[model samples]
Each structure stands twice: as C-alpha cells, then as structure tokens.
Target chain A: MTGRLGFWLAHLFVLAYCGVLLAGFVVQFGADELPCPLCILQRQAMILVMCGPLYIIGRARRGDVTLADYTMGYGMSIVAAVVGAGVAARQILLHIVPPDPGYGSAVLGLHLYTWSFITFCVVLVFCGVSLIFGRELVPRGVRFGWASKVVCGLFLVIVAANLVAVFFELGFHWFLPPDPTRYETFHGLPLLGAAAMSGGAVG
Target chain B: MAILIFAVLLLAGWLTVRGSRRATVLVVWTVALCAVLAVFNHHMAAKLSLNF
Candidate 1:
C-alpha cells in the first residue's frame, strides 16, 4: 500500500465515503434544514475521515518523511474510519428493518428505494478498507512510533465513546434538539490545522 | 472559497513535494475535495433559491 495506486485509491475511497454521507442527509431528510441526532453523528464521522488527507499536507510541509510519522497517524485514521463505517452500517440496517423507531422516528421522507441506506453501507465499506491499510502501513519492526499509537489510541477511544453514546441516545430517543450549538462541538474541532499534521505520518 | 483554495494549494504542494506514492492520493483527494465543495455550494445555492 506504499505506491501511487494505493495512495490515490485510499483517498478516492475516503472521499467517496464522505460524499455518500453528504448525500444521505439530503435523501433521508428532504429539504429540511435540521439534522437528527444520528444524522449529525454521521456528518461528524465524515469530517473526521477527511482529516486524514488534509493532515497529509501538514506532514508534507514539515518534510517529516519518516516511518514514524506514518505509523503514529495510523491508529487515529483507523478509528475514525471504523466509526464512520459503523454509523453507515447502522443506518443501512435501519433502512432494511426499520422497526418501531426504537426512539427517534427518523425524519420521514420518501424512501428513495434505499439509496441513502445503500450509500451509508458503501461509505462504511470504504472506511473499512481505509482502516485496513492505515492500521498496517508501517512495518512491524518500527517500534519507535509506538507512543504515538498509545496517545492517539487514547484520543480515539474517547472520541469513539462519544460517538457511541451519541448514536445510542439517538437510537433510544434521548436526543437534544437540532441546534447549531451541538453541531460545532462534534463537527468543528479544527481537524485541518496542526492536529492533522501530527496525526498523519509523512506521505 | 478562499479557504478551500488554500487547502487545495497546500494539498497539491504537498503531493508535489512527496513526489511518489503520496502524490496520486493527495491529488485525487484535492480533486475530490474540490468536487465535493462544488456540489455542496450548488446544493446550497439551489436550496437558497427555492427558499427565497
């Protein structure tokens, strides 16, 4: 996964994953301005995924083309990708077996023949592929970057927990109202600046 | 729009510097980002028009 094809393919997949979720919001909610709890969760996951390549620019800027840089970022990328994939899977399942709404009755709209559901599944699959490569791009012998893993691992676990709690609340109808206040906390964590650089390995 | 241009420039410059496997991915991502932004703006414009 260290060649041109792999790099482009990885980005392509992640980008596509982002696009699908963006579309899902439209298809599921019609022209409404508000997003449900789960919908917001999905959008946050995508923004996280986008941080990967955005960070690449940061790393490349510092000329830190070492194995350690790449290794360090691997864990964060995988976790973000996994979270995205999970959200997508849940949405698709909801479409297939939309029981009693569990809690949130979902934003009622035209089914659109499961297009939103299917797109979610596709994005999740893409995240899975991104994770597979991200988690292992660095060699096993390169133990120098292990601390990055531990630190970011802790960071992701926290984010992952938040993601789960938010989604679970959504599932159980324990959501707050659609307010911009909530969206910024989850969506606008400044993933594009220094953090992205530190998160990603060089190239 | 300005921020997005800066992002793309930074990404493209990064890919150019890396000069290897990283270039394609970064370039593609840059392209994808641009496309996504375009789509988002288009959707926003359409919605604004309908609302007005």
Candidate 2:
C-alpha cells in the first residue's frame, strides 16, 4: 500500500485499461458492430483515464516520484471516469425500456455500455483507494522494467490503432453517425469498398 | 473532427510518457475540452430516445 508499490501497481492498471480497450475492439470486429458516437466518446474517456497512470509511470521512471504526481495522476483518472460513467449511464438508460435490446450484442449477459459503466465505477473506487493508501514517497532511482516497457509500448500501439480506426470511422466527416454502419474512409478503397458497402447496407 | 481529437490525445499521452509535463497537461486539457464539446454536439445532432 506504500506509494512505491502503488506506483508499480499503476503500470498493471494501465495494462488492464489496455485490455479493456482491446476487448472493445475485439467486439467491434468479432461481432461486426460499429460503435455509435456515444460509444466512441466512452472509449475516448477511457483512453484519457489511462493517460493519468502513464503520467505517473513517466514521473517514477525519472526517480522523482512525489505526492503531486500521484494526486495529478489519480485526479485526472477520476475526472475521466466520471465523464465516461455518465456517457455509459446515458446509453444504458436509452435502452432500459422493455422490448428494447441494447446496442450491439451482449458480452457475458451485459451490454458493452453497461460493462463500461461498471468499469468506470471500478476506476473511481480504485483511484480513491489508491490515493488514500498510496501516500508514502517512493525512493529515488526507479526505472522502467521490461514488463513496464512492454505495457507502455502496448498502450502506445492501442492509441495509434484508435487513431486509425477512428479516422476510418469518421472519414471525411467531423462526426460519426448516431449509428455508425461503415468505415467512411474505406468507402472508396477498392479492397475495402465492398466491405464498406455491405456495412452501409446494414444501416 | 474525432480523428483530430484522438490524434491530439495520442500526442498528449506520448508527451506525458516522454516526461514533458507542462506540454502534456496543456494538451490533455485541450483534448478534454474538445471532447466535451464534441459530445454536446453529438447530442444536439442525434435524435435520442430519452425523454429527459
């Protein structure tokens, strides 16, 4: 529960966040579901939440870990999670009525937005507890181990993938449709045109 | 655009990991603000089922 341990734990949380984001992608492709605008906003909020941990990890690597680092990191995460939770809650409410199946397929008996709400709640709890227990100042000379490096690399890759995915999703447009059906960017590409066309048909 | 927003967020994250605290903070805040605006815009444009 020491600040030092908390700092290391932050890396694991970062990895967990990455896993969640990856799961969303898996559902997107595996289930052939295109994320709606609100869904994309939730994803963006998740990414912003992860950045807080990344900030703390970066500071720890420099051997200058401090209380301010932890505060800023957890504070930013808390704020993002709150916003994400709100978005997810809104989505959940939109489908709460009877005979209304939620957006996309259910994962483990819960829709993705429902799961997102749970995740954001967990984040809030995690940050709150971490802030309370992780008060000790970590010693100097801390550096990134191999696992941390791999996690950070994975995070960067996820961010880059999102960039590409979103660009294609909103291609040539400033906003995504309420119910996105295809990658706009791929509408004209020979290889992906048919896929995009098929997706458009679904809409 | 959503692409530009994510791009900026990615840059901010990268900068944070690279130890550019001030720049990262500024960029993250900017992205957060933009995201809020985009969310509002989406709500305004979309026809929601919610009564409230």
DockQ: which candidate is best?
A: 2
TM-score of each: 0.38, 0.88
Q: Which stretches of candidate 2 lie over 4 Å from their true place?
A: A137-141, A190-203, B49-52
| Predictions in order: lDDT | 0.43, 0.80
What are the per-residue Cα lDDT tens digits for candidate 1 across A7-95? 34434544555445445545434653344433444455454454453343235434443444453334334554555455444444544
Each candidate's fnat: 0.00, 0.48
DockQ of each: 0.03, 0.59
Candidate 2 residue-wise lDDT, A36-148, digit = tens: 88888888889888988888887766677777777888888898898889888888988899899889999899999999999999999999888876666332446766866
Query: Residue A179's C-alpha lDDT in candidate 2?
Result: 82
Worst 10 residues of 2 chain A by lDDT: A133-142
Q: Which candidate is the best by TM-score?
A: 2
Chain B of candidate 2 achieves a TM-score of 0.53
What are the RMSDs of all candidates, in order?
A: 18.5, 4.0
The DockQ score of candidate 1 comes to 0.03
